[model samples]
Every structure is written in C-alpha cells, then in structure tokens.
Target: MQALEERDYFTDYEILKDPYAFFEAVRSHGPVYQPPGRDYLIVTGFAETLEVLKNSADFSAIIGVQGASAPLPFEPSGSDISEQVEAHRDRILGGDLLVNYDDDLHTKTRALLNRLFTPSRLKANERFIDEYSDEIARQMIARGGCELMRDVATPFVTLVIADLLGVPADDRQHFMNVIDAAPPPGSLNTEENDFRGENHPLTVMGGFFARYILERRANPREDILNEFAHSTYPDGSVPELEELVKMAAFLFGAGQDTSAKLLGNSIRYITDQPGLQDQLRADPSLIPQLLEEVLRLEGSTKQTARLARRDTRIGDRAVPAGTKILVALSAANRDGERWEEPNAFALNRPKIKEHLAFGRGKHVCAGAPLARVEVRIILEKFLAYTSNIDLDEAKHGPRGNRDLNYDPSFIVRGLTELHVKFTPAEGVDLSQASSQAETAQ
Candidate 1:
C-alpha cells in the first residue's frame, strides 16, 4: 500500500514504535531487499541470514573501522575506508577486538577469549550472580515499585559483571555511573560526548580498565582481568596494554548493557501479562524456558552489519563486493517457515533455543552464556521474593492497554524506562529470602 521509502524502517519513528509488523512486511517482500535510495541489502529470511553469517569469506565483517558495539550506517563513502580501517585493525594488542577480526585472526582472538572464559570461572561467577540478584530484588521490594530499568535491571547487571571482572567494590559505583552516562552503543550521543572532552563513558571506561590492566600485571590476582593481562596469543605473543584495555572495556559495556535490556524486557513482559506472571511464580522452574521464549520473541540485539567481499548471490539477488549488508536477526527469529506460529511467545516452544537472537556462525555473541546465567538468577530471585508483579499504570499509561515504550534506535531493542510495582509474598522478609537463596544454592 505504500512505497518502500515511505516505509523506511530505521529512521521512521512510527514504524520503530511497533517494529514487528514492519519486519514482517520486509520479510514478505523477499529474502533480500534493497530499499529505495539505500545502497545496502537487507537480508530478512532465516535461511538467507544464516548464509551471510556462516560464510564470512563471501561476506566480510572487517568493515575497516571500529568503535562502539553498534553497526555503522550503511552509506558508502566514494573513497576507500580500507586504509583507515586497516590502521585501526592493525594497531596491535587490544586495538582490534573480537568484532573487527575475521578468518585466521578472528579464530586466534576467539581462542584467547576461550582461555579467559574457562568453565571454572563461569561456574564461580554464579555465586556472585545470585548475591547480586538477591540484593537488587530486596531493594526493589522495599521501594514497593520502581522504574525496572533504572532501579533493578541496570544495576543488577552492572554489579554482576563488575564482580565477575574483579572490579573493586569501592569503585563499583563509579563504574555503574559511567555506564549509565554512556549512550547506548552506536548512538550519536557517543560522538557528541567524545567531542566535548573527557566525558565520553567509553573513554572513561577505557582509562579505568587501562589502569586496572597495568595494576593486574604488576600485582596479579585470581580474577579474569588478571587472566587477560597475562594471556598470550597461540604464538606466545603478549597483547599490548592498550589492546587489552579496549577489549575489556568493550566487554564491560556490552555485557552489562545488553543483559540489562534482556532482563528488563523479560520481567516487563511477564509482569504486564498477569497470567504469565502468575504461571511463572507458581512454578519457578519454568523461568529458563520463559527466558528462551523471550529471546526468541523479542531479543535485545536486532541487526548486525557485514560487507560483501566479492560477488555474492543471496537467494535471487546478486550483491557486488563492498556492498554493506544488514542481516536482520530480529526478522530471522520470526520466520514462519522455521518457527511454528512464530509471533506467539510460547513457553513450550520446541527447538526455540536455536533462535538467532545471538547471531549465528563464528561471530556469535561471546557473552551469551553469562547473560543467560544472569537473567535466570534475577528471575529466580524475583519470583522467590515477590507474590505478584504489575505495571505502574499511573506512571506509564493506562493499566491494561498501555503500549510498551521502547528505545528509538535500530542497534538495540530495549525500554527507555519500565515502571512497575511488586507485591511481596506473605511473611516474606529480606533476611529470610537471603537465607533461602543460600540454602537453594
């Protein structure tokens, strides 16, 4: 009914307000689409999205530059950006993180990461996750209600990640403040803040981590940061301090930010739907499935950018080298051909764990396992302490029919704020809850 440009999804505020229908419209058109005036190709179908992700040789992720976690806008510059990108990528040790590398280099970097995220460290971190989740839930219940994003999800995620990375308790508040001040990844605000001198959250975070990296080297500890400080590539070459700082800072931001979005969205969804909330509280074991359904139906990450290295055909469309392609992870997760009643959030949905919420192939999210553990613990703690959860209609709109307000950005799908009220279970006390949490563990 409308022209393609008329339905411009990314920049159009109205479409972004409720993006699923627009995503479905894009999928219905074809697997690969080049919208009017936009040079980049959008891969929407599940199969097509997989093809691009799996075959990095055909579609290179080496976009010639790096910064925050968001994808750069797809507009082509006449001059080659490769040289500048090369300089950035080649700036050894922590200079180029996981996302910037491909092929052999990507593999090597990933191997080093694997060393850092050992199974034992992850298991040990679960104790801290439980402690952080319980403390945050206690505060939320005491407040009676809160803007879930700011009060609970954000701080909960930030603390767990900080503890995991061995960030000092005294400095934890500063780290939280820094992350809060930083704009969501890929936002223009990052650039504006950087231009204003010394205020950019990423820059501050980089400096903090850089100092910590040096400290960890001088006085090694049993934390992951120390592991990174002492790590070497397969060839036994040590990464530069700058390189280590860049990677650690990126992880700190990316880890907390995306998990907060996921946890907030999951809690808001269940709380908004009373039946689902009750179902989950009655049988708390269902939370893992509930989270999987959340990931499938509405994931935090929506899209990723890739460049075509050579002539490539996705379905029927032929793409030339250097063409930037937008792989729609959100759209692919809802493809009807692959998922039954794909739009419905079914807790028992079969094979739902296979969803592409965390991209596919080599560049899949490194923090996915940690994110799962964090959200799962938060949900469990909330259920243990609260009898009921409901929307704070006075602050957010009408009680039963309020629309969920989401951030107006293509890179991350999350709420700007989610006000909610929690009803504590009868006879529930913070001390008792903490004891029960320990016993359960």
Candidate 2:
C-alpha cells in the first residue's frame, strides 16, 4: 500500500468526490493511521472500528454531539479533550439533543425518540410510501426522464418525512421548498462559511416543529408530533420547547437527507449495471437484499468522527487521549481482509447485515426502518412502471464516459444529481388513456 502524507482529505472537494483510491492507499496503515495536515487518526479496519464503537468508555460521541456546526480545536497529543468539550458544552450544543448525549442520557433520549419510529408507525406509513412512490413513477414516466435528485428522490423522501411527522397537507409544499433552498443534502458549504448556519435546513425544520409543538400543546391532536411533544426525559421531566425542537429537527433532517442519498445511489447502481434491472423486476423480493449490497458498497454517510476519551490502542497503533478518529465506514465495509469480493454488489452476500451503513452500537440511525420502507417502495414502483431505465446520456453524458458527480463532503457520499430516462411499460399509458377519454367525451 502507498502512503500519501498529509493528503488534506477534508478540504479538497475534488478529491473527496472520489476518495476510494485514497482510502485504498491508506487502509494498510490503519486501524489507526494519522493522515498529515490533520491531527486525528483514521480507523480503517472493520474489527477495530467495532472496538471503538462498542467500547464507548474510551471513546465519546460528544464531539459528534457538537457535530459540524460547533467543532472545537483538536487537542494536542497528551492533553484531554473532555475538559475543553465540557467547558463549551452549553454554548456549543445549546442543549443536549440525542446525538450529543452519552451513557444514561443517551439511553433515555433514544428510548423516548424510539416512540416516533416504532414498527407500528412504519407499518402505517407503508401504504403512504406505496401510493406516493406510484405517483412519483407516473410523473417520471410522463416527463420521459428526470434529474432524479430533485425530481424523484428528494421529493419522495421529503414527503414521506412530512407525512410521518404529521405535517398537514397544505403546509407540506412550503416545508419542502424551505428545505430545498437551504443547502444540498451532503455539501459542506455551510460548514465552510457558516452562511445561514443558524437558519440551515435542519434548524429551519426545528423552528417549524417548535411552533407546531406549542400549537399541539394547547389543542392536543392525534398525530406523531403531538406524541413527541408529550415525550418526557428519563428523569420524568417534560423537555423544554427548544429541546423538542432539536429532537424533531434531528430526526427530520437525518431521515430525509440519508434516505434521499440512498435512493439516488441505489438507482445509479442498478441502472448502470446490465441485467440487474430485469433481475430485480422479475423478483422484487431481491430488492431488500440489493439495498443491503448498496449500503455496504456506497453508504450515504461514508464516515463519522469520534473523539477518544482516553488513551487506547486500535490494532497495533497506540492512540492517546483526546485523539480525534475518523471511523471510515466505507473503507471498513470494503475491507478485503474481512469480506470476500467486498467491492462487488453481491445480493447473496451472506454477511450483508454486518455492514455499518447505519453505523454500529448505540448511535445506529433511528430512522433506518422508515428509510428501508421508502426505498423498497420507490424501487418496486419504478421497476413496475418502466420497461427500461437508462441514464439520460444527454444530461449525464454517455454510459462509460460520463462525468459522475458526487456531493463533496467528508461524511456524505451521494450523487449530486442523476438524470435518467424511463421507458413506460406496455399497457401503461396513463397520459395517453387520459387523452383518449377526453377525445371520446
């Protein structure tokens, strides 16, 4: 393996777009390789990443709780980050939201948030996903082709989230417009400039929920938002409005952004491969399996940052306390040492569930179940309604010679846009049928 010194992986937007080569070059030095320019180490081994995830005592997600908006300076080699992080906790975090907490608080918060994404809620949303997906397919077929990012995936996922959150129909369009105008799902542009960082999409969403919570408190209604408003902390105290806003905002933004990326990646993969689309059309049951392969190969959130709470070892490398480690989920999933044919999209891969697309341990995505439902429904509808799906060479260039665009970010691995054509299936001409009926009348 070749070692590239201080590659500056984070700031280089072009390199970040296609970082597989970089990952391959550096994995040999991991489970704890420190890239130059940056002070942190990168955890590249599957087992090692798992160790860090499971042993939270030595690793804290407090840095993650601070997240992109309020990142602190990386402490020098021997210094502890715990103190620095704790000092600015309130100013940086405002208050403890789900991702910011650890131990008992994280446990209780997760339990409370679990009420919104329960199996029953998912089951109830199944019909809505199916109907909405079918509608989207019809729209795509009518257009002949679309920029899948804006036309299909983003709208589909956003609508699903709004419905699940009990946003009234009349208010849904405005909400989507607000989210669309904020920033692209995976872009780090906001992190770079802090432009409207306060009114960023997630914050805007939190603000919306904040008002709704007040209204629901006064005029209690039968909806998910109402239930969430009533949810209490583990100490049996009702959380303040601002806290609820953060919770609502986190769930909505995380759910919508990740699901959109997943759908875009899945479509790009299946459409690019020959015979895969037909294979999936023939047996829709294989979709769940295919989605697993997609996750393993192209996880939406590629990697996440964690701060080491205490000095520890990852593989043979000794990491000191306060060390910032980038857990490479994408690299770990493709570890040739752990997976046979790791890079290939093999639907029958036996250990598919081992993939960390949803992260691991306590911080696993809460909205995963709903995301799965949305993707499966949309794929099924797309395949059912289209005879053939192919990339719009005019929009995205020729099949093998296209400029593949990805969101330039350290964490989000997703296409910026996917333009594709869909040939309507035989006997499936809703538009034509409507025209014929109009003529007959």
Candidate 3:
C-alpha cells in the first residue's frame, strides 16, 4: 500500500472525474495524510471520518472558503478579492442558516429546521415525488431514453423543492438560473466568475424567497413558506426576513442537487447491474432498501471539510489548528475494515444504515428523511412503469470534467449527467395517469 504523503491528496480533475481508483488509493494509504501545499489533511478511513465528524468540538466548519474563493479551478485575482469574498462568506454564514454555523447556533438552527422536515411532512411529499417522477419517466421512456440527470433528476428534485417552499410557478426557472450561476468548486471560469460577481445565487434566491415569505405573512397560506413566515427563534422573536430567505435558499440549493445526483446514480447503478434491476422489479418492497444501498455505493456528497479548531491528533498524525481537513465519505463507505466485502454493491447489506452518506453528528443532513422519501417514491414509480432500462454508453459519455470530473466541490458529489435508454413496461396502463398525477398536483 502506497502511503499518500501530504503533497498529493487534493483531488485532481482526472481523479475527480473517476474517483473509484482514487478512493482505492486513499484506502490503501493511511487514513490521514497531508496533501501538497500543506494546506489540508485528508481523512479517508471510515472510522477516522466518523471520529472527526463526531468530535465537532475539535473541528470547525468555518474554513473561510466560500463563493469565488471556494477552491475553484480559476483563481480570483483582485487586490482585495480574497478579503471581499471572505466578507461575503462571513455575512452569509453569520445568518441563521444551519450549514454555516457550529456549536449553540447550529443546534438551535437545526432544531427549528428539523421541525419543518419532520417524518410526517416528508411522507406527505411522497405523493408529489411519485407524480413528478412518473411524469419524467413517462417522457423519457417515450423518447426511448434521456439524460437521466438533466431530464429526470434535476427538474424533478427542483420542482418538488419549489412546491415545498411555495415558490411561485413562474419563478422556478429563475431560481434554477440563479443556482446555475453560482460557482461550484472546480466548474468556474472567467464567465462563471463574472456571473458569480453579478448574481450570486444564494443572495438572489435569498432575496426572492424572502419576498414570498413577506407576502405569506400578510396572507397566510398552507405552505412551508408560511411556516417560515411565522416561525419564531429560540428567543421567541421572529427570524429576520434575510434569515428566513437564507434558510429557504439553503434548503432549495442543498435539497435539489444532492437528491438529483442520488436519484440519477441509483438509476445508473440499477442499469449497470441487470440482476439487481430484476430483483427490484420482482420485489418492489426492496426499493427502499435498494435506495439505501445506492446511497452507500454512490453517495451524492462524497466528502466534507472541517477546520481544526485546535491542534488534534487523527490516527497518529498531528493536525494544526486552522488546517482544512477533508473527510472522503465515499472512501469511508467503501472502507474494507468496516464491512464484509465493502467494495461490492449489496442491496441487502445490513450495515447500509451505518453509512455516513447523509453525514452524522450535529450537522448531519436535516433533509435526509425528505431525500429518502424522494428516492423511494421515484424508484417505486419508475420500476412499476418502466422496464428494459439500458445505459446509452455511446452517445453521451460520462458528463463531468474528465480530468477533475464531477465531484468538483467537496460539499456535494454527483455525476453531471447519466444517459440511459429504457422500454415502457408491458401492459402498464397509462389510462389512470391523470388520477395518479392528481396526488402530487
């Protein structure tokens, strides 16, 4: 096993495009290593990741990398670009959004956010998810296939979140546009930099959603936006308008991309494993477990970063305070020491529940329950209505950057596109499609 010295750990574009080999390399190496530049520590083992995430007291999420300065391929250069970007990040982080905070603030924000995404609410979204997925699957199968990521996963996840937040129908496209404008880690260029400067998606979406909340307060509606309009802070004071918008924006941004990736990856996995698809089709009840298995196998968020708040030792390596430590969740899920046959894709793996794909500890994803519901609903509806799914290997080869491929940002991991072909199920009646649609409409 080659040891990964501190100099060679940050994901290169080639490695990022196809990370399986890189993950294997990291696993063979010790869990902790300092990559080149001595700027960060990479934690690749399952137990090590869990240790770092669980011990948040010694780690901080505030690594001062956000917006343009957030590890993009194109460097931002102005006399004060770093300072400007840092200021913007601080402002956004200082708001009541859950991901930006730690300690007491994170706890409070998470508690309030948790209430909105309770099991009952997530379960209720199932009907909507099913209908949306059915509509997408119908269109895709009719065309003999489609790019699953763009055609099905992205739009379906986006609209479901829009509905949940009461985003007006007309503005959903605008919402997507803003999100697209935001700079992900390695995807940026000069054009992207200009876009980020002019229309930072988070800021724009935050403002847009805040206005909606203001309107909801004036004439209350039966939507989560209304709930946000009325939600009080722990101090019994209403959250500020900006805070409300930021929270909704966070949910909208985080929810759609990750879920879309998971859904697309699940479809890809099923197509890749013909036997597994048969198993799922034969026993539809296994759809839920299969989703869990898919999450473990091809997680949407492959890595997470934490800054050492104080000097700490991880697996005998000394991490200095202020050093960025990245935990590769994908590597952790495949850690051989933790599970029997860790690299194999087993839909019935009993230890699937222990995977940190949704993360763990105080900052564990609050939207996981909702995300699971979305995946299950889509898989169930898809299998029931479609058959003979096959990958379109020739036309659109894998979509992420071949070198520093798809999982550009450590914050979220997913393929840029998944193209596949499929045949509609035999004798599967679409006559009742309208009625089925009404459930989500």
Candidate 4:
C-alpha cells in the first residue's frame, strides 16, 4: 500500500474501510497533528482526545454530527466566536441536535435525559430485554441462518428501546415501518444539495412522540413516558414541547444505531476467533469483558467533530477558534502509546473502560447503559441458542477474501449487513424459556 498519509481521509471511500492504518500514519506525526492541506485538525492522541472531550468550554459540539463535511453558517469574528455561532445556530446543520448543544444548554437539556437511563429504569427494563432477545434468538434458530443486521440487530434494537420508553405496544409496528424506510442513524449527508430531508427517521418518530408527550402531560400516567413528559431542568422549568420531542427521538435514534452496530461488531470478532468463540460459549460470564474490548477495538462510532470555541493549544499545535476538529475516538482508542498491542483485541486489557469510544464529559453517550444491556442480553441469547456460529462463507466469501461491507458513513463505522449461519444447540429448550418468562410475569 502507498503511504496512508497521502490519502484524503474525508473524501476517499477506500480509506473508510480501514482508517486505523491511516490514523497510525497520522499519529506518527503526533496525536495532535494537522493533516497537510486540510483546513481543520484531527486529534488521535489518547490524552488529547480526552482533553477535547472534557473541556467543552473551549471545544464546541456545534459541528458534532456534521463534522468538517458541512461548513459553519458564518465566519469566525474574533478570538472567541461563541456569539457568532449562537447568532447562526439555526442555520447550521445539526446545530439543534442534543449532541450539538454546548455548555449550559447542553447541561440542562441533558439533565432531563437522566430519567431514561438511570440504574433503576434500566433494571426495570431488563426483563423485557431478556424476553425479546430470547424471542429473536428462537427465530434465528428456526431459520438456521440469518442476515444479522437487517433480520436481527436493527429490529431487535429498535423495538427494545421503544419498549423501554413506553411506546404503546400497538404503535411499535408503525415505528418499525417508519424507521425501515429512513436513513440509518448517523448515515445522513447534510452536505448533499438534493438530500431527502423528509426521510430522516427522527422527523417521523418525533411526531409520534409529540402525540404521546401531549397525552401524558394532560393525564400523567404510571409509565416511563409520563416521567419523561414531566422531567424538568435544574431550575425546575419545563422544557418546550419541541425540546422534549427532540430529546426522546434523539435518544431512541442514537441508542438503536450504536447498539445494533456494537452487536454486529461483537459477533464478527467473536466468531472470527474460534477460541474466543468457544470461550464465550463455555463461560458466559466473560461476555461483559468481551463487550468492553469490543467497544475499545471496534466501537460503533468512529469519530465526532468539535469546533474550537476559542484559540487553544492541543498538545503542541495551536487550534484557532472556528477550526473544526475531528475527535478521532477510534484512533485514540488504539493509540500504541496507550495499549501494549494496540491493534490486537485483548479481552483482559487493564483499565478497559478508559477508552474514548463513548466519548467523555457531559456529552458522553447518555443511553450507554441501555445500549450495554441491549447488546449483552442479545449476545447471551445468541450463544445460548446456537451450538456454533460461523460467517456464511457463501455470503462473505472464503475467510481471507471476505466481502463484508461497512456502512459508507462519515461518522459511524458499522457493517452494512452480516450474514451468519448457526447450528441449533441440542437440548436447549426454547419452550421452557418462554414458559419461565410467562411464569415470571
């Protein structure tokens, strides 16, 4: 291969398949190195990435989703362009997103989200997740083979989060129908002139949430949606209807996409190593450790964008206000300086949770607990239901020359689809599992 540094990380499609090598090529220049000819900075250093994620004051998330692909609405005015950003926030793509808000607004809007992902809430939702995972597992077993992403992960994740948030059972099919037709979360290209804005899943799902929020406010119910509808900020002021809808929709979209991708990543790695696969099947307790390693090695999110809110120094490089910075989480996670064998997947890596995959500080993925439980429970189910799992050789081709395709997105890194074949475990009783589920209820 030619010098990885010579490739344009943004526009080059082939580089997306394996950007880590490119990241390493850049890291050799220093973690905080600016690519030659690029107008923005990309942070690959472990510590520097955390520094950017932690100090939200100096790094604005206004470009959090769009990244350097979409330009700012207005030019930087001075040493600190905070006011200039606010003045044109409405015109900036993704500026209104919960992930894009900064400082006080971010803190406040994020506060209402606590009720959704709390330990108590997640615990209460576990029984449903368990049943759903088992339900999907049984289906996979009956089929003997499956398209993992479409047939399994996507629907499995979507329904699980919707159920947790108290979307009425009758409305779930409608939710799926709407979501099935829209762009995968984190796949939007706002830079396109003719982008189909109507096709965003959030726009349709937000309407359903709007109706539910209104109904809940008029007659507070005993469900999670009631709590969600009535959640307030630190000052106890109620957020507007629009804000509540965005929060709920954002939570559902973000959680579903990342969790499903994590599941896909987990299965691919586990099955790729037969020893690791056998270890997981024999000792289910190691699933959690496997998850942590998976998140560190092949996280669902590749990178998130940050705008320098003021002139600041990241390591040796000076980042000016308005300069867009791509917080290369994948690169930071695999920084050789931080890990002994950075590219290798080591299940027992020390301080495993320290990776910047879910980001850090206030903007850390709020739905993370739910995501963990979702991926974990489903993985446990897959193992329980199958005697052995193998990549469908016909679909992906022979081991060395596989044809698995990653989603062509600028932000998230995930498979476009995964086809797997499994042998049903002998003596595993799905009927008994269903009976136990009914008995518990």
Best by lDDT: 4
**Residue 371 CA displacement from its true place in model 2, Å:** 0.8
Q: lDDT of each model, Cα atoms only?
A: 0.74, 0.76, 0.68, 0.82
lDDT of 1 at 202: 58
Q: TM-score winner among the candidates?
A: 4
Please provide, for model 1 over 19-67, each residue's C-alpha lDDT reduced to its tens digit, 9 standing for 90 to 100. 6777777777787877766767777799888888888777767642222
What TM-scores do the predictions have? Answer: 0.89, 0.91, 0.85, 0.94
Error of 3 at 5 (Å): 6.4
For model 4, how does the per-residue alpha-carbon lDDT over 1-441 read when each residue is reduced to its tens digit? 657776777667766766788888888888887777777888899989988999888989998877765677887978899999888888877788889999899889888888788898899899989987887787677678888888788788888888789988777777766665555544544333111265566777888999999999999999999998988889989899999998888788778889989999999988786488778889998998899999999999899989998998787678889899988999999988888898998888899899878999979998888888889998998898888898999899866577888876667788988999988899876553443222211
The C-alpha RMSD of each candidate to the native structure, in angstroms, is 4.4, 4.1, 5.7, 3.1
Q: Please, what are the lDDT tens digits per residue for candidate 3 over residues 33-82? A: 65545556677888998998888777765542232123422233432233
The lowest-lDDT stretch of 10 consecutive residues in candidate 2 is 432-441
Off by over 4 Å in 4: 1-3, 185-196, 430-441
224 Cα displacement, candidate 3 (Å): 1.4
Span of 10 residues, lowest total lDDT, candidate 1: 432-441
Ranking by TM-score: 4, 2, 1, 3
What residue pairs clash in candidate 4, if any at all? none
Candidate 1 residue pairs in backbone clash: 64-85, 93-243, 94-243, 95-243
